[model samples]
Target: MDFDQVRLHLNAYKENDQVIDAAKYLLYSFDLEHENFAGFGLRKAIPNLFLLITEGELGEPQKVMIPPNLFDFDLNLVLNVIAHEMLHVRQKSSINTVEDKNEREFQAYYEMLFHKVFPKIPNASDFHKKIFADKAFEYYRRMGENSELQQKYAAQKKEIEQLISILL
Candidate 1:
């Protein structure tokens, strides 16, 4: 999917999904704030206060960054990537290390699952396919052996699964 297609789907989804709307607002706001910083020479004078104000429910990330080659990927792959990014927007944090990166990814996947962004897989026949469920742990190896992050990831995984179980 290309940028246009992503925007098309997002426009549709945004009609009913407030999450996307809020994300766009935060993203655009951040962009405008940054532009002002450069335009008005405020980059070092003061921090972006809107960012510091909304700390937990929303953090640093405002926009979803898309690569130049996203148009080459399959639609499902593209959607999965978008979902992953939206999750990051939903739960951004102060990323300062590799462990932080991995943990954030795990959290994004958990958020995706909880939000039902994952495509369903019913038959065991297609188990080997690169479906959302199959490729969920593709980034896990980077997590290393950090037991605390692992435990947090596992607990949240289970919690999200249980929540999914109840809702679905």
Candidate 2:
């Protein structure tokens, strides 16, 4: 579906109004499609997410889960995270291997950092860097050394760093 239809779908939830607004902004600003999404809503306990194939089938309706804590963060940060999860939702089908999973995450985080939709969010670049250095990169670092996974991880890490040097 188109952006307006997606906004209407999100508005119909009416449970997390702020979240719906953020989702709407991301959808409109990025021109992301809504046909694959079942809906968007708050989900407790689970981390912010999009329902994945592992939870069911790729053909099953998928929902984006917004962590309630997002209300405590910056609007820009919230938008970026929601955008990241939405990218996950869009790419949920491409994850068939651990390497593919890492690549998807890298892509999402990369988009989150540098999609050029909105103007730069104050400190958002720093925040994205920390997420990569502390979590995502760390996870990849722990993988078996010199293995294909580690190699792919290293390559992505270098690529992101190089891009960041040029962009930020």
Candidate 3:
């Protein structure tokens, strides 16, 4: 989806009917140096986020930075990425809590996952797909060979679910 399409969708979203008016987040590029390594948020968050913290992080030439060395994906992925950040724009909450942060990331990632497809975006690396994949692994309660990673994943999932239940 292009900018207009995303705007239209966001404008018409049933759950987020007031998104256009009530949206309280600033959509910024990866360049300007913010808290999020890929994209940042306050609360209503989730499980996994790619934190590319290498030296010499250059800004991609767009409103939202695409991390030139990372993915150059298509309109939907880009829009979803934007939407992910938008989802982070919520009323002031005590995000200092780890659970709150995970909840925020979890919700944003779930929304992003809901809109993603696993096709090769033209001229873009697998970075977009990889991002989705990482989120998927977290969201779907996936298991892997690495015991330590699995344990950490399991713990995070437990906390995420616990937080969701409390929030609901």
The best candidate in terms of lDDT: 2
- Tens digits of per-residue lDDT, candidate 2, 1-168, equal 253654455455444556656555556665654455666666663445332121224545457766545444444465566666666666664443223566656666656655643333223557555564445555555555677767756766676677557655
Q: Give candidate 2's error at residue 68 in angstroms.
A: 4.7
Ranking, TM-score, top scorer first: 2, 1, 3
Candidate 3 TM-score versus the reference: 0.31
Q: How accurate is candidate 1 locally (lDDT)?
A: 0.41
Off by over 4 Å in 2: 1-18, 45-59, 68-72, 94-100, 116-125, 162-168
| Candidate 3: Cα lDDT at 59 | 30
lDDT of 3 at 34: 35
* Count of residue pairs whose backbone atoms collide, per candidate: 0, 0, 10
TM-score of each: 0.39, 0.59, 0.31
RMSD of 3: 13.8
**Best-to-worst ranking by lDDT:** 2, 1, 3
Q: Which one wins by lDDT: 2 or 3?
A: 2
Q: Report the Cα lDDT for candidate 3.
A: 0.38
lDDT of each: 0.41, 0.54, 0.38
Clashing pairs in 1: none
* 6 Cα displacement, candidate 1 (Å): 9.8
* Candidate 1 ranges beyond 4 A from true positions: 1-58, 67-73, 93-99, 110-141, 144-146, 155-168
